[model samples]
Target: MRLEGKVALISGGAHGVEGEMMGFGGASARLFVQEGAKVVLGDIAVEDGEKTASQLRDAGYDALFVKLDVTNEQDWENAVRTAVTNFGRLDIMVNNAGTGGPGNVEETTEDIWDGQMDVHAKGVFLGTKHAIPEMRKVGGGSIINISSIYGLVGSVGSTAYHAAKGAIRIFSKSAAVQYASENIRVNSVHPGFITTPLTREGLKNPEREQFMLDRIPMGRIGDPDEIAKGIVYLASDESSYMTGSELVIDGGMTAQ
Candidate 1:
């Protein structure tokens, strides 16, 4: 019951693009509820998002689903309003929505690059911008921005994604520095080689699985639950003195 009396708003909270594979947002929502919080799950996938919220409710958790296009400020305003209106206050905000920019610089279009920036960088900016007022009203809060291991290092075939994710790293730090006095802690989480909707198709082959494993010291991909645990720690009072930190849960990929 780490979050026994709290409320959280998660962007991209549906299970996945197809609603089957659990993404970080969805997994975190489940864990937050299990630890006693009322969660509001937001996503662009209407059917799948609603289904996730319904399942949580059926399982006896307090949850709500809202259609959210993270790029839209109006959509973000509505989502935050929904959380405060239904759950009473917003204690946590998880900006976890992202698009996989799947091409190299020479092959990627301006439109493709902008699309990734909209969700990964701009979206996080807007989420932090709006969630702050409500959170301050309650005295303090926690904001979690989901970055990728790519954010911390250079990678191939996704230059645009790397740019946007790296932007989040600095953005989170700046926000943390500005809000530390208010008790509002802002931190970033970097996940590596996790099995989510985006990576499931790519990891189907045994050879591909082995290829990814060879890079990780743990010799395996990560589970969504493992990352969720990290988010819970950052969101709860357990990490009361922490702020502006980057929690890297990459199985030692960045150690090298």
Candidate 2:
């Protein structure tokens, strides 16, 4: 019961595809509920989101699903409002929704760049903006932004993705400092080669899978559950004194 009595809102909280592995937000939501927190799941994947929530409720966990397009401000507002109205308070916010940007500088179109920025950078900003006031009302809260290892280190491709994720890294630090006095803590998580729906399509190529496996020092792709454990730590009081930090869970991919 590390998160006992707390309430959390997780964007991108739907399980990816019916039979596929879960995403970070979906995995995190389940962990939070197991730790005794009521969770409000927000995602645009309505069917998967509702099914996830229904499963949790059947298991006797407090969970709800709200349609959320992270790129939309109104969606963020509604998601946050639902958490508060339904659960009474919001204690943790996880900006974990994401889209892939695959292209080199010349190959990257203006639309691709803008779309990447809207989803990764703008989405986190909006989630933080709305979450702050409510967190303030409850004395303090934790905000965990999902950044990529690409945010910290450069890659041969994914130009727009790197740019957008880098924005999230610095944005998290700025938000952390700005709200530290209010008892609100903001941190970013950097993941590498996780086997989620977002990366599954790419990993289907044998060469691409080997490329990732070779790079990771541990020689294996990480699971969403592994990252979720780190998120649970941040959401709980276990990390009360930590903020403005990067919790990298990449099997030492960036260490090299």
Candidate closest to the true structure, highest TM-score: 2
lDDT of 2: 0.94
TM-score of each model, paired residue for residue: 0.96, 0.98
Q: Candidate 1 residues 9-75, lDDT tens each?
A: 9998988322468999999999999999999999998887898899999889999999999999999
Global fold similarity of model 2 (TM-score) = 0.98
Tens digits of per-residue lDDT for model 2, 38-134 = 9999998999999999889988989999999999999989999999999999999999999999899999999999999999999999999999999
Candidate 2's error at 67, in angstroms? Answer: 0.4
Total clashing residue pairs per candidate? 0, 0
List runs of model 2 lying over 4 Å from the truth: 16-19
Q: What is the lDDT of residue 214 in candidate 1?
A: 89
Candidate 1 regions off by >4 Å? 16-19, 205-207
